[model samples]
Target: MGIAGRQNGVTGGMILHRTVVLVGMMGCGKSAVGRSLAARLGVQLLDSDAEIERAANATISEIFARDGEPFFRDREAEVIARLLSGPPCILSTGGGAFLAERNRQAIHDKGVAVWLDASVDLLWERVKHKDTRPLLRTDNPRKTLEEIFATRVPVYQLADLRAETLPEYSIEETTDRVIEVLLTRPDVLEKT
Candidate 1:
């Protein structure tokens, strides 16, 4: 039975009550964990970055290089709003998505924000080899990541829920932790 699916507290099929928006720093496993959570919950997974890429017909890096970060952020906000307004599902937002007050307000209004928290060491290990992150493509990428991480943690903590990630945990383990957190909020995920 799905985690939230229940009738009189007995396991059955779940009905998603609200969108679960995953917010965190890059390499924090938001996408991977969100995908697993959605599958486990029998729901769809909406990735803001992928959605933005599809809408713009360009990669995030391409958009940044061509139109700049402001333009990319504008598109990101639009995609996030569109996704949140759609249905109750798992939404994985880009690392910087929750940094904007407008985006945070929208998420708070329409969904439950779950910050997939991970240490900078773990995040660095995960993103060190990835070229897809535009913000990390600096001469000193590690330093850049550190700076971004420092600046974003406070904002991410504003999320309604927090799912901490560790290098020792597999994707399933992380997803399980997230589920535990979500279940604590009956309005977000019921026992049934």
Candidate 2:
């Protein structure tokens, strides 16, 4: 809590009137930044993936393997809708969540989507070593990532707000950037 920000009530604290749905590529730090942003705002961070896993009683990869991507997506949508219907909180979604039009509409109708933008190279570097990503279990993950990136970025651009995730910035810094962007949408968040 910087004195300047706290005195001005810019970054010191805020009242969230709507759920903030974090949308972007997998490695864009949605979960990490959501944690920090929720903490800064004195609210809960509900991770859609975690919620789905809890209800299904399985890891994401295991769910994908057992029930398939389509089934997982159906469950994801349900979880997202359910979370959005609750009181305002930070919602971190899976990378593919925003790609679906139904999910996008639900988010816009109930919450605000904040895209956490990152370059394809940055995203690849972050996710390449992680086998937990069921989608990246491919013969050429880098190429697959490129395709996914190209397909999804345009959709991500439709978010109500956006925050850049620079490799040089720490999670806290990125979270601050998210706060700055959210501050712009006074209807969604307000200084308190």
Candidate lDDT values, in order: 0.85, 0.89
Model 2: which residue pairs collide? none
Clashes of each: 4, 0
1-192 in candidate 1: lDDT tens per residue?
Answer: 534442122223445677999988989998788878887777778889898888889888889899999999898888899998886888888777899999999998989999989999999999999998878889999999999988999999999999999999999999989988988888878754
**lDDT (10s digit) by residue, model 2, range 1-192:** 654443332344576888999999989998889888887876778889899999999999889899999999999999999999987888988888999999999999999999999999999989999998767899999999999989999999999998999999999999989989988988888977
Return the TM-score for each candidate structure: 0.88, 0.88
What's the lDDT for residue 76 in model 2? 96
- After superposition on all C-alphas, the RMSD of every candidate to the true structure, in Å, is 3.5, 4.3
In model 1, pairs of residues that clash are 4-192, 5-14, 5-192, 6-192
